[model samples]
Target chain A: MTTTAHNPAVESHGHEHGHAEHHGPRGILNWLTSTDHKVIGLSYTITSVLMLVIGGALAEVIRGQLANPNGHLVTMAQYNELFTMHGSIMIYLFAGPFAFGALANIIVPIQIGAPDMAFPRLNALSYWLYLSGAITMLLGFFVTGGAANFGWVGYAPLSDAVYAPGAGADLWIGGLLLTGFSAIFTGVNICATVFYLRAPGLTLFRMPIFTWNLLVVSILILLAFPILTAGLVMLYADRHLGTHIYSVAGGGVPVLWQHIFWFWGHPEVYILALPFFGMVTEIIPVFSRKPVFGYKGMVFATLTIAALSLGVWAHHMFTTGVVLLPFFSIMSLLIAVPTGIKLFNWIGSMWRGQIWFSTAMLFAIGFVVTFLIGGLTGIYLASPPLDFFTHDTYFVVAHFHSVVMALVLGGMAGLYYWGPKITGYMLNERIGKVQFWLAFIGTQVFTIPQYIVGLNGMPRRMAVYPNDPEWQTLNTWSSVGAIMIGISTLLFVVNIVASWKKHPAGDNPWDGHTLEWFTTSPPPHHNFFRLPQIRSERPTWDHNHPEAKALAHGKEDH
Target chain B: MRIESKILLWLGIFFGLMCAVYWTWSLENAGGVMMFFAMGLCFLPGLYYFWWSRRMGYRPEDDPNATQETGAGYIDAFPGSSIFPFTLGSGAFFVVLSMVFGSWLLIPGLGLVIWAALGGIAEGRRGGDK
Candidate 1:
């Protein structure tokens, strides 16, 4: 390891002069074959955005069909296809990939000061696998039966070749297996990089909140996604291999699908959730002008949630009459404690501080408020008796939309927060704020009406409903809110286009503390020039204001 | 590294405890075994880190006296560029299509995977192309 005449550390290392020597080739080759994490990450985000558009369009069709009861805008079969693709694309394609695939790839390595992902080529491979999987799934739209209508969960007997009997069902299985494996590979890389490649002095406790979240999330993904893959394989076997794993006529238990799916499904919530929670955690402390209230508590709470999520899958299956009610109900309820701790930590961080309400901060605040609603409503779902009334109702729909606010609002916050850093361009603040408020109001208008209708016994995933006046009014208003959301999302794209390559975001635009802000706005090929002093979690802030007591050097908040 | 290993060790112990509790709570539930695998997942990486940290001793980061410049050196050699990822993905894609298209794809699908593996390995052994 010594520096010699041929030392890469001196002549070739180039850190003494600053930055790694090459930026590599430009244009398509760099994107296609280069193993740079940033390129792959940006590819992930872009693909998710494209999928988001497709998923959103499908939502509009669903709303169009449901705006009035007994509506016939789409064929009944097409309505089924629309909702199924909407859920699958939003969950598997947009939400999960954007959080874990894009955000983790972009931030984790930089946060740890690693040169690149542990498997740089595999990182690139993830993007390709993701793209091909997405295409494979989208290919269903053109097939004869017009995509899988068995629902995103693809429950048993319903999803069998006998019931579905479409190429779409087979395509759905193939696409997910590829994307699922892609995710599992990404998890392995993140785990390896974080465990093995932290910068000197960046100890476990000293790692950034986002990095900590990635570590736990990678573990969650590794542990959870494989079950989904295995389950899908069994489903495929039942479909193509002529097996009876889920077919009742062949002596298969239908509840087995519920067991297998929920085992992977429940943890998938946290797998998608923990990273945005990480992003919000990072954004809150920075804009609040304080160190995080409980860094260690945040870490432990994240770990606790991951552990509890494992045993609580049965909570989703309580209505099936097969789940152990007490054990799962208790475990599911215990998750609230850790989640509550995190909420309080965020609130405490903002107390009495010079809070800057940037668009990112605004989204973070919105995420906090909405995530609370999502979590509290989940209590009813966790109870076996209570769930009997609400399962498969619009109450569940409202709950889901609220829960994904983390992915929606929290994701928007991360985009505003990190988007500048990634692109080296500042998004228009005025436009961003306007989009934020519209989306905020639209989300409330959208979900609250559903809660009312659901309690009135309006079932979910229904294309046409009986014409009832109250249900009609609520349903129409919900469609209005969906359109508002649609417009606000379009405005976000306008902001991106308007801001691109215009106003250059100088390094440390937010005056942040993490290792990411220590480098350039977009950073370099190697991600660092000269390493900043890594004394504590707030490295950049420490380097800038050496004597600052607030988020100062060497001050660990126990 | 020391703290990370300890944290993961505790998490491993925690998940292991849950596995035992869930198993004792319900003998026929298969989800208990999932918890067992979760424990093993944590311990495998956690213990590997623990052993390696002990073998290599504390990095300069863990040493309080280490200065900013102490970590200034060559990072690992990042692969400049590689086409095998695309090749490997294509290979895997064809294999996935085998699910829809029948078993005939087993030949070329697996063949490309093997080809990419050999190419990637040879490139790594030869220190990769310039």
Candidate 2:
């Protein structure tokens, strides 16, 4: 092995001494107080997974109630709280944080060839703030009024003090404010690290797709989250201080809340999805044994998607009648082009390539197929005429579920793909594959019928429906599917535990293409023993194939 | 930056054209205003990156096998345990609780918040000397 005498910044921090000493901090106190990105990342992942279980439990309750017509699983009020908390917990607490907070914190530094985030202390702060927010949100359940019952959107007038006079909604507002601050902090950390950190020879274009996606996610967070934060403050004032931010009688239009909320809400959808898309982009190419096809196009398309995302907020408000429908509709349609380009590029990468059917690849393929369905259905909803019919219906539910499920599946794929790198233990492949199939099939079974019933004029957030046989039948099937999803999630936990001690994954478990793979499995505290010579976008590939420049240029295809 | 600028420049033009079309369709609506603003925002970043990249050419990040000197010798420094994060979290908790409970908690909550913020800045400066 050649050791290049490089700058002092590239020097390892006495890595040969051993892992324990150099990694810094130990015991329970260290976890609570440490600024190590890896520790913070693990903390974030654990918290998000716990929240996933809590949120998923809420979903089970919802499915149980909807299983039978006029079901008395709980009263209407409890039903409202359950569903509201379900959406809020899953979106705010689980998906967004899991993707950007956990995955990004763990992977971005290693992928970018940096030791840690730019502001490690701020990174720690972000995690603690997030945990605080999660606690506060859950605290709403113990309060007198129950958890926020105006749905997760907490649309105004309904959420007003007159209508919802209690500490529950106030708690919801407080929780979200903290979480928004956490997100903004994390966003700043990510942007700064990517801008300032990066190993030599890793240019903006040469960076891995996942890091690129995170960069865009950071920008979107910085720009979009403050709007939500401001809106929350205003709502809090309206409720507690008797101000009239959203009260129509007080000259404040209730619709103003929709404008502010969806401005953050729509981009919030992308904040969750882009990281998943980036993960899939990275996973597909590596398993297929090819460099990502059209790497530049992938980067360009991601940025374009992000830019267009800012302009499409009104698409969510089309049925509100206040939004200019044509503008939003056109922007929504245009946003699809970049997304379509990504799908094409993914297929192009897998084209004629030695595609592996690993658990990760299976989920990635599932994401592509599922997200395509989601995106296409979204096109129908983007049109004002069509949206008027389906808005707040199960069709819309099915559509967004498809989208969110794709994101969740993508996150799972990333976890499996990077499990070895993060934990030094390969997840049990057979069990992983089983979990993947169950989840995929279960999600489809659960959500597909939502579209059918929705088109049949079933509204969303409804506690009960008329005793119609067809609706009952569809709802029962959906509940069964939901059960399958629950069982699949349990299998995933079992796989993690069962494989915890088995199959010690070596450094390059999948012969990965990026810098992170060049290091030890569950990489050392300093990330690298000595950094590899980067020659192109595929640094590890270049290091391994020094004599095969032609292969690097794609002249000799696999 | 170079590649980013080119991509953004073209996207700006594309959105600019879209704005024209939307404007022609609806002259005095929120949609046109949004499209017009998008066009402007897109162009600003596009031009900035282009200008910045031209000024700083052939950087280490742009070339493979380049010496690692640019980003080397900089092991990330980790700070020891500090109380500010916990205190800040406590401040947030009490402040929120004050809203639900009463105005009495507000004084302590805001006081703790200010105390934590000042302590956090000073803590870092003190650590630098050590």
Candidate 3:
């Protein structure tokens, strides 16, 4: 328990303590042990990039096998491991850390005008723990029994030691347990920071939409992940100690795992998507040169999405033969309202403004287009009968990939747009546009036909499809598209590295309105030279000029 | 800054020590429910010191103004060292001792004691710094 520390510039009658800035170590040695929020953020970004490449390579190998029906490039064991690692690495290591964790570490403090994350050293600890978990799980690949093949879900008796009989399952559970702890610790840190660390005059209502979205996300992680920890611990007990948490013969219920996993898993979708919502909110306002449409409404909608996310886990469990469909259906439909609100907000934010088709904006627009199709199809999958048809089919695969691709692509857009500010250098826009188009076209070429293939009754996770004439053309096209997508991803890496040092970017390259833009590009050890006065959500807007301020604030009375 | 924080600090230490003892006792007894309960107990003193510190008028550890962007207190609370010391050390200590000593309850029981002692000592020191 500590006193609420007030910024030096703000002279409240509150008591203040003189803090000695502790500089522990120096150089790369310092970075290795460094607790700086920015350094930790860089660590997250670098780790995520490496994981993305690893996961993408796995995807390529799997797609190569499935390129043609019954293509014998890999054994079933190899395919199962590939898909499992692909899903786990992409979701946990790539999307989770890179998108929210990295961005939040870098930007959230800046957005709120705080100097750094509330817990910088703990921030470093969370990243290390996450890396450890990810590495341990990947190491299972080289083990004697191979990796866990019960899918990333690591479902019951199939994952049981008796049925699976391997050290792989133990490793899987252990890795996830460690990862779950990291997520929770990071959530705790973020929540505390957001609650207690806002600069003077920066009220909750005045916080940026991205910060608001992350606030809801942090809460969701806190509420959802602890249960996942509990569930993983139980599963580990069953695997190693002969406990019967999921064993029916031992009086344990197998369906219990599904309930616990999806409870966390469903919110995990929002955990992934909500930050994209935040980035979209940020991008839309900047490109349009307009205040975000319905800022308060967007905040409310984000919170609603996080809240309703908890009750809809059963939607994924519908085909499991034991789900409360009525409850799940109601919950699922309820989620649509908030999601639809965000959709309208994005569209409304872009309405009638001078739309700049920057590579960043292209991905934002791409997200909206792809997410719509994905959302509509998601509604179909929410239904019990429809899900039964789409269950295990390429249709389900198509719908999910669409949603996830839109989400991750939006994240990529945010990353590139903000990377300059974070690094104090501009990306190679020429190569950026190339990479964007390649990814945009590659996604469509690769995934759009997945819906058709799924409808034609192609089961997912199969290394080889039987010689069904209907699935051939689309499957071949999808595989080719995947290769293109992989190439584009590589170009994105090249573009980032090539321009890392040479390109120059100013503090406000996009002329953004948020508080983050008020500081130096890449900022300093302490984010701001002197903490600026915060009146509204957009502090930089006020500091930039009084005339621009009047334009934004003018609508207050109107 | 105040006498109350010092008292609360020692109070935190006392409860922390009690928690450590209770946890170790539970581990040596090999009671699964008790072991779980002990883990929960470990969170109490850290929380109490945190609460008491705030009440006693110390700015929060994470408050940028209080920490001065140097992150001194953050590391003290949650150290990045491998938690396997708690997990594996305790798990192994219990399993091995039970096997060698032919005492089914001895290893897990002592394992719990070790976990409680270590966790309590670390957390207690974090609060004692101020």
Candidate 4:
């Protein structure tokens, strides 16, 4: 509640000098060898953004090829590799690590009042493993057969040794295996930190929403990632050891790959999604000037969603006809209930509250609107009949793009929201708004036509389409949208560089409600100088409004 | 804890009944049954917390004005510079690379992994290093 500009505690501490004196290892060596959580988090974030640029360039290639029917932009094999590496890079290298590795590492321990992770060495190992994995995966581009072209899921028989027959596929499996290990290490660290490192007065129900979400994410990573790792191990065996796990000619069932992959795959969506949900949960309340509405409902909803996520894996396998139709259908539909509850809670938090339309808030609201469309279409695809028609089509492509757009936009919101704290400078708001609008509009413009083409019986993952004039027009519009997205990303870079030292953002730029805001902007080596007395979930709120009402005992239970 | 457990207990009962209905209609309804079971298991944490809280009485987290000592203290000791992370990363890369190149690379890969893992664990015990 105490403003950063006026806080005597911040002035007295002189954290920058004190921090450097205590925490040794200066310069680039510090970055490579340091065990500090903040340094590791920044490294993860920087790497992810760079990966995003690489993935986006591949996307531009895909769009350029699709601009015209029977276009000669790329061969069929090149197209396959482009899409495969694009999805793989974005999911494995960017979104997942950006959320869990970068944001959670920096934010969770601070929120819980822990100075560093439970296992700092393991944390550093996780980052190094991730980087090594990314390099190995990208190494495929320079190889003989190019990158693995079996799509991101790497569905079997197609991904088998007979079909793939190269070191590229091997590299894909090995890269993912290493990243899987990285995720497992980070997941263990997060779970241990949450359980053991919480501050005084920070109980289970009283923890911040972002911390709660990360806890569930850690659990999901711990339980779900090993399945993919095991599956990938089998895939490697089939490719190199001449095993018959997925090869149909060798008396193996290819659909078994689908089952194993989607089991991990479905939960993987939530791995990327839940953190954004947490970001929006944090952003909405701060901008709305309200405590999160229906706090217990939000928690229960998040838990239920994670549980249901495990059961709904077969929804992706619905069109394969090997899965149980009614069973997967019912479970998938049921997931909508908990997800809808979260949407309602977000709106309820904003209802009749004083609203500020900061760029971060705009993106959070954008996430809500965008993700709703994705969730609804997901339900539509949950139906066995609809899925059978739209299977492997542009509709499915549009659906996932919408969902991923939500995650990416929400992540941007968090980046901007926490920019002041992370960098000690406020981002230029005018440029930020321009970037957000371009991204929002461009995403809609790009994906809406894909749905139209999908309904008109166009398949996905094709280098060239039939020479229909209508298809060309739609593809052209979509390509324009892709260019817009690219420009918007450039604007983000401009904003970062443009505002590097223009404005010094003091500690609590947004009057934030969480514990991280209580510390200085770009917090010291040890995060907090003196801790606030935490009573409830909103410790800063309690600090600010001491006499608003007698502290409501177990109000979070409501 | 008591309040949340009681709420989830009833919610679990409600979902359990729904699972029964779905199970009766289709005996092959594994997804519905499993989903409901998972939902029911979500209540276990709340139940455990409720029992733990009742037995232990109030902790520092439950009281607003608890003293600083009641809180979990400052961070435990952090490790200084070590080559374990780099060595472990190198070991993993080579192991993966061996899958492509040949079995000969596996020897050094496995050795580095073993050395790094052992060294990382031992590095923590050297007192006053950091």
Candidate 5:
């Protein structure tokens, strides 16, 4: 409520000489008590990288187990735990939080012509809570009975205390609850920051594509996560307090949990993808060296995707025996319209413009191709008949990995593209292009065979398969491709570490139009000196060419 | 210097006693039925209490601020920022009542209705302050 004018005193922290002395805090105390969003973002990114390795290792375990029929690499219980942890880590901890919690924290405030987040302390709290929740979840593995093996969904009856008795399930419920709390709190902070902290002339329409997508995504999180938390509470009560929320013995429907979870979970899918949409929007314009084509259309498409995402939760439940077919199918098909509109805008943004084929742009363009195929496969899954055939098969895995993994990969691309701007150092571009090509090829080689094997009735999560000669070649191919992804990712790490000391890109290397490019690369504690008045969606355009600005607004020399 | 802590202690003890009695009576067999009946009876009065609380000199400062960069100052920039005084309070009362009575859906249903009504009022009165 304390209103203060824009003050440069609040914004100045970096000395020109100090930039060379490591801008972020160093050592243990620096990490424990740090409030800088960049430091927190780095923490999240590191954790996500570690989890990706863990998730990929689990995939190797899965591949080894499925290498031959009657393979004894791990017990069924252990296999369940492995896959559950893999899915949980990949979707929730790795991809979901990185795209939003890390990137949005580091980027949105700067892009929106603000200093740091409106609530920097609360931002720190969100990260700490998330870390606590993640630790608790990992502790579930070391506990007496081992981690929750009922998959990340923790579907009822399987998750019921009667069937899956122990502290394992309880720990899972508790950890997920804490994680959900972190997500909700982060959402609230982001939403409030975007809404209340915009610079004077910056209206909602004029927001950068990334910030716009974040605003939409954060609102989705706020609306969706609370219901998920409520459902988790109900699930916890059933496990610990002997409640009948989802217990069949107590007349509670198991499918109710699915309904509530997917209600959050489906929007969760968009929450994962929309920021990448923003990334693409931002990158296309910069690399193209033209104004983003159809900026209003892009914004509308984002909102449309968010709105449509909410109604399509039941698509995940199509094979649950009692799920309504026509309703979910219709909703699923309806989502494609908005998604198609977004694709059109992306393609339109790049058309007939001078294109820069940087690693970031390569990955962005790769996303379109991979995501397109993923979307086409999704349409097949939308139908009840096709889903019946494809449920729990490698084909579904292929579809999800194509779209969702592309999102993660695209987010990484954005990081490399913007990290220089954010940190005031250039990343080794040579190594980055290598990382991009390897990831692209690895993704195709791994996923395409899975699609074929899945079509041939190869079920997922099976530790072993009969020496069905058909699946052998494909599985081998997938394994090899996984190794490639692993290697490429390692090279990416090497590139980062090598460049950390030497490579430096002064502020605004990309000559970008967004507000983030206004300040010094790797800005201060309080972000900007003076947040410029935003009259159009592209304020940089307005500033650079007064004639164009006058012409666009229909104001002549008079 | 430490006088405030003693006062907080006394107030905590008083609330603890009231809560103990309420919980014990609600969970016990014979007393629980009576408690359930009493709770059902209290719903109307509880709603009226909330209505009265709205008319009190309640400020937006009473609610937790959504953002933290304001450096732990609990007040947000908006006026009339709370629906908590009505919904959270009413929710607690209903939850306790329903728990005692064995009605699973009562509290959540009532909470939803109250929230809807509040939303209607807010929407109807939009921009009046501005």
Candidate 6:
């Protein structure tokens, strides 16, 4: 079914077709000094996967400790360190890096039909900064007092020199600052790439949903992260440089820290979310056998969501009592409209089309359900009166899990969908289907009881709770659910591991629509030898089935 | 029309509109000012791209009638093999290390950083064959 113009069988040898620089040094040396986007992307991917393992192990320990009311598997202090490192690692290391650094690096240039990233060396530097920052953060566990335990938010006085009197706190600040810079640089590179380098017919509007979302997320990172950098610098000053920006004893407002942190932190939620949304959007269309229902609407919704995210930061500060209630509440609720628009487009894409329930498609569906649950709970928390009660409760815990589960589910879809393209092998879908069900059931099992105990007045971040039968029973069930999720994750790892030496997924395994599918399974040093004529977003789809080539040119909404 | 500018222009207006709405509704809070700042952040890049589009004119992709061949041939030079990123990363390692063990660590940290910076510039200017 391959097109005569862009045949994968012939052009698969394009690496040797005059691009002599493609045949560079082998193995480790190639990786070290190399500026290849694929190499850098794999660096980001492998590192984030390892960080996920570290964070997951910490979570299993946390679940074990909370299995019984009196279960003190680790001391209270060490427990703080566990959750703290876990939160930091997942956000900064696992989720953000995987979504932004790894996926963006590996896929963006290919989708846009570019030779490489705009600033290839700067792209390499971004990965290096991330690596150094990751090492710095992990190095904290071995230090005198273990990593920053003032919560991942690092809420002021708790993070001050008095309470967390350790070098770990300083290291945490330093590490985040480096990672922050890394994110900013990556953001710049993506923006520049989109602005400058598009293949002939790849106009801004013609670009894929994935590229649009990365562009918006990059802008968000550019604006949102520097605020964190400034706030962290001030906090560091209060700790070592003798300034009192957050110290109430020294007349510095403690609430100011909340304001600054959430300003960065709330947008950080959308930063984590929008890319995965893009991933689901990409997958839904492929499996459903249709173009996206509304391309312009998705792009506008993304822009609207990003703009609104900047103003709704104070929704997180409702419990602090100093925030503007109506302003933030209305803004936070308004954001739901744009997100709802995205949901409508996804459902419409699958509505009457030939929907296939592949492993990736199942995960995308799971993401929709989980994201809805998380978004609704977030809506409830936006109201100041309700948030006052549920601020630090297990309900919030459940809500956070739902949100992060959406990330996990969406990320799995991306991995399954793109893994063949990254490594030239097909992932076993039978194993994948089993893994998906396990994750789907396990997350709900873990999250549902958390909502129950939370609504029943159990506060979160608790090392140990009082010995009550209701709390004890629910805790045991939740731990059982957590173990199930761990097993599910382990199965995924095995599936990917087994995939290493199995059947070769030839180019266009899915008979896909994008430019990436036109190239070989794991494309050459330069991304594409030839791009299909981009009359519509689904160019490759048009080329493969010329009978429907005219039909593939979608009547996109103006 | 450079379509990149159109994309950013709309995004900038979205941010600016939100800033106006938020400011009018809640000027009493400090968040209004922050919204204004956010608007500026969007506009800076958006307007710069707009200006660039005006100056440099349409990209090959901007034309509906353009062929794929028009976009071919050396777009720009990308770095081939370079040792500077490793040097820069090592320099950053020591700089972060300085945060843990007194300020004495900046000696090696800043030194290596400076060395990498100068070396990268020289490598770029030399145009290969070091």
- TM-scores for every predicted model: 0.95, 0.92, 0.81, 0.90, 0.77, 0.95
lDDT of 3 by residue, A37-111 (tens): 777888888888789899999999988898888788889988888898898888877887776678878888888
Please report how far candidate 6 places residue A206 from its true position, in Å: 1.2
In candidate 6 the C-alpha lDDT for residue A57 amounts to 90
Q: In model 6, how many backbone clashes occur?
A: 0
Pairs with steric clashes in candidate 6: none
Q: Which DockQ value does candidate 2 get?
A: 0.35
lDDT for each residue of candidate 1 in A309-369, tens digit (9 for 90 to 100): 8889888777777778898989999999999999999998898878999999999999998
Compared with the true structure, what per-residue lDDT tens digits does model 6 show for residues A1-558?
Answer: 001112111233433344423545578877877777888998999898888888989999999999999887999999999999999999988888888999789999888887788887788888999999999888899999888898888998899999999988888888898888889989999988877777777777777899999999998998899888889889889998889889998889988888788888988899889989998999999999888888889998998898789888888778777767988899898999999999999998898888999999999999998888888898898888888888899999999898998899999999889889999898999999999998888888898899999998999989999999999888888888889888988998999887776999899887788888888878876677667777777778878978874343346422
lDDT of 4 by residue, A359-450 (tens): 99999999999999899999999999999999999999999999998888899899999888888999999999999999999888888888
- In candidate 3 the C-alpha lDDT for residue B40 amounts to 43
Best by DockQ: 1
- Model 2 residue runs over 4 Å out of place are A1-23, A550-558, B1-59, B75-83, B126-130
Q: What is the docking quality class of candidate 5?
A: incorrect
The residue ranges of model 5 lying beyond 4 angstroms of the native Cα positions read: A1-27, A67-70, A541-558, B1-130
5 versus 6: better lDDT goes to = 6
- How much is the lDDT of residue A509 in candidate 4? 86
The sequence of per-residue lDDT tens digits that candidate 5 reaches over residues A1-558 is 111224222223223212212333357656654555666677777776777777778877876776656678899889988888888878777777787888788888777655456655456656765665566566667777788888888888888878778666666666666667767777777776775566545556667889988877886776578777888889878876879979878998888888788877888999889988888788877888677777777877887676556556768888877655775688689878888988887897788878998878888888888888888899999998999999989999899988976886788678877888777898888998898888888988878999999999989877777687778888878877777777888888898888995866776787677777767777755556544445666665556566764123223222
Clash pairs, model 4 backbone: A201-B61
The stretch of ten residues in a row with the least summed lDDT in candidate 2 chain A is A1-10
How much RMSD separates candidate 4 from the native structure? 4.9
By DockQ, rank the candidates, best first. Answer: 1, 6, 2, 4, 3, 5
lDDT of each: 0.84, 0.83, 0.71, 0.81, 0.68, 0.83
- Per-model interface RMSD values are 4.7, 6.5, 13.0, 8.1, 19.0, 7.1
Candidate 1 TM-score to native: 0.95
RMSD of candidate 3 to true structure, Å? 9.3
lDDT of 3 by residue, B1-130 (tens): 2322332244334334533543353232212232233234324433554576577554433232232232222222322222322343244334433422346757574776567557645644663212
